[model samples]
Target: MSIDLSIDLPGLHLKNPIMPASGCFGFGREYSAFYHLDQLGAIMMKAATGTERFGNPTPRVAETASGMLNAIGLQNPGVDKIIAEEVPFLAKYDTCIIANIAGSTIEEYETVAAAFNQTSDVHALELNISCPNVKEGGIQFGTDPDMAAEVTARVKAASNHPVYVKLSPNVSDIVAMAKAVEKAGADGLTMINTLTGMQIHLPSRKPLLANRTGGLSGAAIKPVAIRMIYEVSQHVSIPIIGMGGICNAEDVLEFLLAGASAVAVGTANFQNPFVCPEIIEALPNVLAQYGFSSVQDAIGKGVSVYE
Candidate 1:
């Protein structure tokens, strides 16, 4: 039986539910050499700020048990360069483009959002208010409900593209953050943006990462991601782009069952550059094996079964 893998979110129509999570996929230049970019669903570009950011110092990444810690500090070439250079390159493909917008202040967020208004290739904006590696802006707005809502509202007012807030797993209540953003007019959500973690170098007797703490991703965070998606989906009406520790097709089906309409592959991309296409190829068979006829059919199934 042929299975349907397409998924329709707020402003994204994905051929399949697999897209590389932002930051991990960069701007898709390197991955283009691995396979055809159009074969995947959407491409969530690396975080873009109002100005070009050099990011944090070296020793910014470290490996852990079943996962890795990263404090890349939202490095990027700023919004202007991205729209002029990156978007054009991605437009060559037939897939959707989602820009990950980040800023150190509300005005910066607004500035970046407004800049995207000049371009039509970008399908949606992933408001990155949840980056834990950074010392300011991201995590501050992400953890506070009122601040999250305010930034969401400001970005919505500034950009024409659909706004999807990336929520931090570091928050005390993930559902509260989801509701605040939704009420503030967010189009959708990208949940569980990596839990804040750290590693120590036994030789130095100090933190492993240069920034002392970093966002953790890989197979280790999958269960936490699934639980957050399941809980938040029950409380909010907006669609969610679930991510964290997604390494295979089975993981994609699990995220859909939990409540995500679509899923983003993050750290897995680092392990296997072709992981997104690989999972997309394996999704249909995996869905059929579990009795799912389509990607949409699996969404929220886990929540409904308990309800």
Candidate 2:
């Protein structure tokens, strides 16, 4: 039996429910060499800010047990450069382009969102309000319900593309955050953006990362991601693009069963640059093994059965 792997989200029509998570996939230049970019679903470009950022200092990344911590600081070549240079390059491919927009303030978020209006190649905007590696703007707006809603509303007004808020797992109530963004006119959600964590160097007796704390990713965070998606999906009506610790096709199916309409491959990209395509290739077989005829059939399957 041929299982259908296509998925339709707010602004994305994916051939398969596997796309590289923002920050991990960069601009798809390097990965394009590995395989044809069109073979996969969408590409979530690295986080873009209103201005070009140099990011954090060295030793910004440290490996932990079954995971890694990063404090990259949303480094990028400003929104203008991305639209002029990077966007067009990726646009050459048949895959959907989702711009991951970040900011240090509400106005900066608005500025970046407005900048994307110049490009028609970008299918959606993944609002980076949940970046834990940064010290300001992102996490502040992400954790507070009112602030999350306000930024979502502002970005919605500023951009023509569909807006999907990336939610912080660091919040006390992930469900509350989801509801706030949905009410603010968010088109969809990208859940469980890295849990805030830190690592220590035994030799120096200090923090491992230069920024002290970083957002953790890799296999370790999959359970937390699944739980958050499951909890939030039950409370909200908007679609979820689940992420965090997704390394294989089984993980993708798990996310779908837990309530995600689609899933993004993050740290796994670092391990295997071709992980996205690999997952996409394996998805149909995995779904059939679980008795699912299509990707949509698996979505919220676990939630409905348990509830």
Candidate 3:
């Protein structure tokens, strides 16, 4: 049997189940020079807010074992800039463009999501509430079930595009959070955003990131990501976009196997600009080797309970 990689989200569909995570690929223009723009599944643009942010100061990135700490603070050119410059450039590419939306308040998220809906160039909205570096209610909304659900409900009310809540891994019970968003009419979920972690300079005895704590993302986060995907997938029936520390195609299979409807590539973009293309090309082989015809067959393939 031949497995088909084509999958559909609430308001958007893709040719494959592999997508580039937001904040990794810069508006799809940078990657266009590296490889064919249409090779991947979809493009999740960097997180954008209602207004432009200058981002945090330097020393925003701290390297850790198998992971990295980042305090980027969602420093995008704002939604208007995206509509004028970024979206037009990305529209030229023949792939789904998921606008990753972030804001400090509920109104902020709604404003950005509504703007993305109006752009028409955007295919979906990926809400990134998991950023610990921000103050206006990012981690607050992400970690609390009520807040997460409230944000989802408000954004859904204002958004025309499909909304996928990109969850934070820095919570106590991830399933609760997932269920909250699911109940709030969330179209889909994206599990396991960067975990909250920090690094410090021994000599100075101070945190490396200007924000003191940064979200940790990279190869080391795969296990946490997979576990969260499994938990969220088992709890909710909505489609999920799983992402954490994916570095290769094999990692792609792991997320799908853990029950992710689709998987995202993040920190790997910085490690190797070719990571997305390589995973796109390698997915077929990985499926075939795993006795699967397509990535769809891999979803929820190995979920089991310890009871």
Give the lDDT ranking, best first.
1, 2, 3
lDDT of 2 at 197: 93
Q: Which runs in model 3 stand beyond 4 Å of their true positions?
A: 1-3, 304-307
Tens-digit lDDT track of model 2 for 182-207:
99999999988988998888899999
> Residue by residue across 199-292, what tens digits does model 1's lDDT show?
8899999999989999999999999999999999999999999999999999999999999999999999999998988999998999999999
> How high is the CA lDDT of each candidate model?
0.94, 0.93, 0.87
lDDT of 3 by residue, 235-282 (tens): 898999999999988888888888898888999989999998888878
How far residue 179's Cα lies from its native spot in candidate 1, in Å, is 0.6
- The predictions' CA RMSDs to the true structure, in order, are 0.7, 0.8, 1.4
RMSD of 3: 1.4
Give candidate 2's whole-model lDDT. Answer: 0.93
lDDT for position 12 in model 2: 89
Q: Which candidate, 2 or 3, has the higher lDDT?
A: 2
Candidate 2 Cα deviation (angstroms), residue 173: 0.6
Clashes of 2: 0
